[model samples]
Target: MGFSKLFIFLFILQTLLAMALTQPTDQKTNIFREYIGSVSNNVTFADVPINPNVEFHYILAFAIDYTTSSSPHPTDGKFDVFWDTHNFSPSEVTAIKNQHSNVKVALSLGGDSVKKEKCYFSPFSVDSWVSNAVSSLTKIIKEYNLDGIDIDYEQFHADPEIFAKCIGKLITTLKNNGVISFASIAPFDDDEVQSHYLALWKSYGDIIDYVNFQFYAYDKGTTVYQFMNYFHMQSSNYEGGNILVSLTTEGRGGLSPENGFFKACDMLKSEGKLNGIFVWSADTSKGLGFRYEEQSQALLAVSHLHSLV
Candidate 1:
């Protein structure tokens, strides 16, 4: 072949190799995550049953950028622990992880409301918010020995780009500093919320580890067919992302386990799309006897084993 032809061939090979390296895989994993501490249910880490077969994660419900005083006001970018420290303290985090070898702990940021007022992503500026967030969150993560962080800012006081820049920078800084091993964004199907998260995904998707889409936030009577379609829709929305299937123990919304959540999970598992599963909270599950938690982990474990077969 001529020199020019050889150069073209090598370029095509390198392009294919890069595409193979960058593309996301659909391999299923036996990973289960749950949000704890947000509901202030006096629930402790030990209360939840742990399945050793699955990689379990207990994500503390929230560490909001707000004050924990009586009024509970926002602090621009500064974050403070708003979780149920009475039961789920930093020490509890350490104890749980130490007890369960397959367990990891993460914290979510910006829950729905604070003191009846909406918790907005009202960062004063991207630079300042990221700086304050990094400083405050790093202290909390180190103190708790947490493994990851989740973004759950439901309401946004800023535009899409501003929200994107603030969160994108925050995740980037935390990962770069080795403060956290993984990070996730908890986005629901709302138009406004999706816009902001999509903006973040568009800009810094490579750095993001997971898209913890809140499918439970959908209407309460969602069917198995609707659930599967929703999952596919979101899979398309956040393309090439490990979107975890979610449910709420509070019976608030989405497809309840009694209504075929695990069945949907089994379907996803068969297609190798069941990357992971997470729940809205451990707080409610504690009162409900944690049967669904047991079921979820069992399904994930069985799915993992079957996948190997």
Candidate 2:
């Protein structure tokens, strides 16, 4: 072959070989970019973009107490009656489903005030309460197509054993029909309550997908030190699987997302035992309540932690 032809041939061969080696790496990079783009686009009021590599604890189905006394009450104006007909708006529920497809949104049944009234009846009660609850929830699921249900039966403090049985029944029924179930539990600080908590956990573990610890009420402070102490204590005590550490972004002495909340999440990630993070209510942020941008930064901060894996 001529010298010029030989030189051209060698150069072309080298270029082809280099392109072949780099193709897979370049394709992977592109795929990752696309995946991240898809996730970012999916951000909504209910969920923030989580790192695809890390499995996030379930994003709480931001709850609004639809009972009688809530700001926007149903026409009947009775807590139980109102709950039967009124629930979250279709748009609000849609926002949750769109934002976090993989995450579960458990409809929290009761709130602090709801518990005070002793409104929750036994799970075995043949009263209209269970039927009403199930019907209301079914409407929500059908309308918003929620991933799961969260029974926040705070009223059950008086008779938690019976309450637990009721909750277990509800959970079993939901799971058998292919729905997820989560239970939002009070803090287990006292020895007596700790025993009850353990019993409930043991009994409901099969039916309950996860337990969200109301960590904020127990650990009210402005610093990471206080939050961490509370978190560690709870983790040490509760040796259960998929225990989610929760905090409130609003309400009495709640932690702001920018404050120690993100730091606490990082701390949990470092420990290699973090399941997920839950914000109390989406309706109660400082300025832009539950909007994507306001919550996005907080989620991004959690996603950035290298130790999340």
Largest lDDT belongs to which candidate?
1
Q: lDDT per residue, candidate 1, 1-309, as tens digits?
A: 999999998997777555433322222477788898887767888989988778888899789888756243577788888888888777888888788777889999999987687898887778898899999999999998999999999988899999999989989899999999889999999999999999999998888888889999999999999999999999998888889999999889999988999999989988889988898788888888999999988888776655544
> Under the 3 Å rule for N, CA and C atoms, how many clashes does model 1 have?
0
After best superposition, candidate 2 residue 23: deviation in angstroms? 22
Q: Model 2 segments beyond 4 Å from truth? A: 1-87, 95-104, 114-136, 181-197, 254-259, 286-309
Best by TM-score: 1
TM-scores for the candidates: 0.88, 0.60
Candidate 2, after superposition: displacement of residue 290 in Å?
A: 5.8
Candidate 2, run of 10 with poorest lDDT: 29-38
For 1-309, candidate 2 gives per-residue lDDT tens digits of 999999998997777655443332211111110000101223334334433332233333323224554432321102221121223345655654465433334455544343234333333342343454455555656565555655444434335565555556656665666654334454435564565566666677655555566766564455777777766777666555455555554545534555667667667666765565555544343234444323433343333332222
Candidate 1: lDDT over CA atoms?
A: 0.86
